[model samples]
Target: MAYELTDKDLLDLATGAALLGTGGGGDPLIGRLLVEQALADGCKVRVLDPDELDDDMLVIASAMMGAPTVVLEKVPSGREAVAALRRLEDHLGRQADAVIPMECGGLNSMIPLLVAARADLPVVDGDGMGRAFPELQMETFGVYGVPASPLAIADERGHTAIVATGADNHRTEWFARALTIRMGGSAYIAEYPMTGAQVKRTAIPRTLRLALTLGRTLREAKQEHRDPFDALIDALKQTPYEHGQVLFSGKVTDVSRHVSDGFTQGHALIHGLDSTGTMRIEFRNENLLATVDDRVVAIVPDLITLLDADTATPVTTETLRYGMRVRVFGISTPPIMRTAAALDVFGPAAFGLTQPWQPLEEIAN
Candidate 1:
């Protein structure tokens, strides 16, 4: 069933999206505010089921690209996505029947809501990546050979660029990143225009609803004096996620972070408080690897998320601070991300870790 998203649901939506972000999706704080303001200004947004679309309907996925830290500082003009969407439709010479999030984390998840609202289109309750990922081509759409071409990049200053990716999807990310860097480290993008039939086949369906359910579970767990962490695990397991485990509970001990090749690259060390061992996590704009006592606990493609041990609020990679208490969780990626081809793009080695790609389930065993 389709539902209208009112102002009251923004907080939970952002909270849940941030949890699924796995430590990188830009801040949902920013996303929530955008949606909230849009609602306050009286824009009605509706979340629609992917199945509601005609197979021939046109859809486009959109997101903001660049470091989350950068976007936090340079707030968008609020018109960037609509401008990009307009340019994209002009480039394609057809109207987009709907808008969808490129990924279901932090800013990306909510950005589509704004886009769909401004464009007067329905926001699909699905995304390319069921969770957050760093780059444009890391989505299931890219994995399934959906080209990111006729891509539209726009910024707060009204500058828009149309990029043509003829045969290579990697170049799509490279170009978008370059443009975003020049646009002062953040820009809105609209790409991967696909027919409704393609969307049904390749997209992770009902992810926004999933985020909402996860968020509601967390909130209810806390309200009823239940374990929110266990609630989170249960919510995920009941969904297509299927497997989730509490990887560690600790306090931040040390962090090594720096910007390299346009990404926030770093590692964090967490000292065990209850688990009795040190844990290490690595990232590139997103948490990619987690290790405990020199043993790999989780790697890329599978999610390594950290939450405030007490409140269960998500703690992102950029926000990891010394002395903060945290509980880490390892959840299995969707089946779309575990395939040999997907692994080749996002596995441990793709991030330069020499360790072989191992499932978190196997690692737990």
Candidate 2:
């Protein structure tokens, strides 16, 4: 069923998207605020099922690209993403019929809603990454054969660029990264033009709603004096993520992170709240690996996230600091994302991890 997102729903949506972001995707706070501001200005965003699309309807996935930390300081104008979409349309010679999110985690999930509301177009319920990933090529659209350009990019200042490098999504990333870095480490983009049929066949389904469900579940759990972690784990059993389990619970002891080549790259250590063992988590914008006691418990392209130990609020990678209590959890990726072909693009190796990709279920056991 199709539904319209009201202002009341934004907070839950942001909360869940941040969790699904797996410690990347800019900040959901920024994303929610942008959507709220747009709604206050009288814009209404409607979400449509991918099945509602005509076979030929044109769809564009819109997103923000750059370091999560940079987005916190350099917020978008809420107009740049629409501009990028328009620029892409001009280059493609056809206006978009609908907007879909490039990824469902974090800030990018809401980016499509903002663009759709401002442009008076509906948004597809699905997305490329069921969870957020750091780079453009990591999306299932790219993994499954969608070309990422003639992609369009825009900065807060109104500059727009069209990047086209044939079928090489990787080369597209190189050019886009350099362009984004020059744009002050953050920018809005529209890419992966697809027909409705293609979208239906390729996109991760219903993750926007999944994020909303997660947030609502956690919030209600807390309100009802239930355990948010248990509630969260139960919620995943009913979603595409399939399952989630706690990996560790402790306080951040040390964080070693730095921004380099347009990514927040580094790791953090968490000391047990009731034990002496320490768990280490690594990242490149998104949480990539979770290690404890020299064992690789979770690795990308699985979903690993840190939440506030008590509140279950997601903790983004850039904000991790020494002494904050955090709970680490890992969830399985959708089957499409775990296929051998998908691993070639976003597996641990894709992120330069030496370990082979294993199911989060297998690793947990």
Candidate 3:
């Protein structure tokens, strides 16, 4: 079935995207609002199933690749994202017939909709990562040996560069990080040009539907005065790993952020309101680890979500600050991400942690 973009769909899209993000994707609000604005402006965002594409159709995955904090302070001029895609297309000497989101989490999920609307192309109903990861090379495309280089990065200041490198995925990430730092800490990137067959082989299928469903479930649960967390838990039950503990329920008491090596590294401390104790979260653009009383409760590939304790609305790591009451929840990682290939791309060492990768289920239990 064809997925039509609508305001009602944003809620599910955000929720499902967050779940898929596995703790990275930044916050979804800005992207959600941007998509809403685009739709309001009469931009039609159409979702095409992966199978609908011709084998030879050239498609590029596009998204904002930088510090989420930077995105908030320097709101996009609204042209750089699509411009980046176009620049890549120009460099590649091929017109992109469709656009796919690199992932479905938070900002990434909604970004393709906006890009597609502006570029007048169909947004694929799938993504490279069913969820989100921090680096440019963490997508399923990378896992499948798709190079992230020979890509495009465009800034709001009208500066654009077509970055081509011979490095592997991790090295490509390092290069992009350096460039993003020089570009004032954030830029729009378009990479991983692939055919439909390649997409089908590497990308996570039906992620768009999952987003829509998660969003819709959250909305309906709210309208009916049901527990949104429970609803989210139910939706994610079919995925790998077990549901973890509710780490904390409190307001953000502190946030520390700095841009280094082209990534935003930060920590957020939340003081509990209910019985849940104080929780500290460390992030690199996207939330990476959550600890309560110095005990690791959640890690990447598993999800660590911040929601308004009362309203159950998501709060971005960038926007999290003093006195914002939030309920912290956790979910397990997908099987694909738990694999050795996936870990090499996003494991503990990949994020600078010396400890080994441990699924949240084990830690929580």
Candidate 2, 26-107: lDDT as tens digits: 8888878888988999999999998888989999999999999999899787999999999999999999999999998888
Q: Which numbered prediction scores highest in lDDT against the true structure?
A: 2
Give the poorly placed runs of model 1, Cα more than 4 Å off.
Answer: none
Question: lDDT per prediction?
Answer: 0.86, 0.92, 0.79
Give the per-residue lDDT digits (tens) of candidate 3, residues 25-142: 6567778888888888888888999888888889899888887767768777668889999899999999999999988887888888889988889989888766677788887788
Sorted by lDDT, highest first, which candidate order results? 2, 1, 3
Residues 1-365 of candidate 1: C-alpha lDDT, one tens digit per residue: 79999887777888888888889888888777887788888788888898987899999998988888787678886789899999999999999999999999888888999888778889999998888888887878878877878799999989999999865778988988899888888889999999998898889899999888888888999999999988887888788888888999989999898766657779899999876899999888889888889998898888888999999998887788899999998888778888887877777776788989888888965
* Model 2, total clashes: 0
TM-score per prediction, in order, is: 0.97, 0.99, 0.91
Of candidate 1, the 10-residue stretch with the lowest lDDT total is 257-266
Off by over 4 Å in 3: 15-27, 238-245, 272-277
Candidate 2 regions exceeding 4 Å error are: none
Q: Which lDDT value does model 3 have at 229?
A: 83
Model 1: pairs clashing at backbone N, Cα or C within 3 Å: none
